[model samples]
Target: MDWRLKRNCSMAPRQLLAFYLSLCILSLGIATMFWFQGARMIMTFAWIELFAVGLALWVVARHATDSESIVLRNDRLTVEVANGQQVERVEFQPAWVRVEPAHGDQSLIELSGQGRRIAVGRFVRPELRSQLAQELRHALRRWQQGAARPSPV
Candidate 1:
């Protein structure tokens, strides 16, 4: 068996920030041109341009949420989320950290080890992601506590 499971996800914050920064720089160029032309009509155009920029930011953030994937396998745990042209990957082993639910049965889960916690599945809805995190935690915790080694993945 291939033993690979893929979950579609989104990009990280740094990537989103970079994309937004670039967009703002481009929007500024357009705004500067309008100001230099002294076109009274540019005022109206500027507002529209601002709206367009806002829309672009929203698209990038929303797209970042959709164009992501979480891949789990035996040897390593990999999370792939994209923002703009950048792709981010986070990987670790079961023995390295602990996965615990952050909220109720319907909340996101917390992955922590050696004094750090990363809440995974931020893009997914609260309830379902919580359940998933719970299941994974329960399965992995047993192994960490010396119960039994889960078959890799």
Candidate 2:
């Protein structure tokens, strides 16, 4: 497969941060108005709400960088998976790798070879996982055939 498959989250990190900041500011602004009106209980509620929002944003931020990048180039297949703070990278010869589903036919695609196993197609919908596997198989087959051809003397 002469292709690069990148599956990143739909929301960017900056966008998520900006949304969290803007919403917090807006909510706090309304709370400040209520606080000045002598409704002191509203202030406590507002603080609680702020804390809740912050927690939610923290969770979202953790997974904001989740992505999978699979690149096939120059007789090498590179698979990169990023989840939160951990990242995994593995390389395999296109001709030696095998592609299949990790579980059922609808499950995630697994590419294994040379003592390494990598699962891809998380960003793809579950229904399309089989399709993705088929495509990967076709690409690998083509790559193997091309690599096996003899060069002209």
Candidate 3:
């Protein structure tokens, strides 16, 4: 069985662009009205609001690409995590990796072996972390069964 997991991104680039365009048009219209009313302070407030909104949207957009991708193939279990611009990857021999929760009952899945470790399931709901862990463990077992390499230490 092949295993892959990723976060559900809520926004797309086209949607984000449309949102920005609409927001800009609305802000310009409102600011224009205020400008014609002799309220000069409105422009500063408008700019501040635009900045705030842009910053907030940027954060949401950045997170849209944030995700965890896992693939188990060819005796290797590859894990990749994308958080904004930074991405972390760890590869392990399927026979040696252990999958467990990071904490007691409610936490992310921690995959460890060969003195290396990586946490996953952050995109899954807290209540479903256990289920995700179970799934990973099952996939690991399947991968190990078909391997012909020397036993893991």
- Per-candidate TM-scores read 0.46, 0.84, 0.88
Error of 1 at 45 (Å): 5.4
Best lDDT among the predictions, by candidate number: 3
Worst 10 residues of 1 by lDDT: 1-10
Task: Write model 2 residue lDDT over 1-153, tens digit each, in one string.
Answer: 333444455677688778878987888888889989977788788789888988987888788767788777666889988878898999998878999888898888899999999998888888988887887777777677776344668
Number of the predicted model whose TM-score against the real structure is largest: 3
Alpha carbon deviation, residue 61, candidate 2 (Å): 2.6
Please, what are the lDDT tens digits per residue for candidate 3 over residues 1-153? Answer: 444566686668569878987988899789889999998888888888988888888888877877888888776888988888899999998889999888866788899998999998888889988988888887777666654334658
lDDT score of residue 99 within candidate 1: 69
What's the distance in Å from true for residue 8, model 3? 3.2
Model 2, global lDDT: 0.80
Give lDDT per model, in order: 0.60, 0.80, 0.82
The candidates, ranked best first by lDDT, are 3, 2, 1
Which residue segments of model 2 deviate by more than 4 Å? 1-10, 147-153
Candidate 3: regions farther than 4 A off: 147-153
How does residue 139 of candidate 2 score in lDDT? Answer: 71
